[model samples]
Target: MRTVDEIFNEALTLPNASRVLLVEKLVESLDFDEDITHIDEAIQELWIEEAQKRIDEIRSGAVKAIPGEEALAQVRRLLEL
Candidate 1:
């Protein structure tokens, strides 16, 4: 059987339209619980709200922004990697 990385690399080479159809078919195959739609909506809404709060905090100088590379380095240190 083809490994996941092999399958993924093959998928990446498809035209954009075909790649979209492939993704739709793959998601359909998962056949998630009917309640997953509602759960996904709630999760997305929470993330949107969280993003807005962060934006407001940064604008108000309540929080300072750091470079993404610096943040990633801090995370790697905390994880001891």
Candidate 2:
């Protein structure tokens, strides 16, 4: 397995947009267990549960939503674009 630095260095060599897409594909293709075929389904269910939890938190005023434009601008700044 590659170390984090090695992986990051490799990722950095990819074009910016390609790196983002590659990361998205890598995340989507992650396998939790070689012995478990249902791992992706399990992860999907967990994500749904976590999303619902966040929704509940927002409903209860425990979390605040950021505006879409503001979030986009922040990301643009972070990426220096």
Which model scores highest in lDDT?
1
Q: After superposition, how far is residue 35 of candidate 1 from its true place, in Å?
A: 3.9
- Residue lDDT tens for model 1, 1-81: 999999999998887667777998998898675569888899999999999999999999999999999998886665452
Residue 33 accuracy (lDDT) in model 2: 58
Candidate-wise lDDT, in order: 0.87, 0.84
How high is each candidate's TM-score? 0.57, 0.49
- Count of backbone clashes for each model? 0, 0
- In TM-score terms, candidate 1 sits at 0.57
lDDT of 2: 0.84
lDDT of 1 at 16: 62
* Residue lDDT tens for model 2, 5-62: 9989988987666787888899899765576647768989999999999899999999
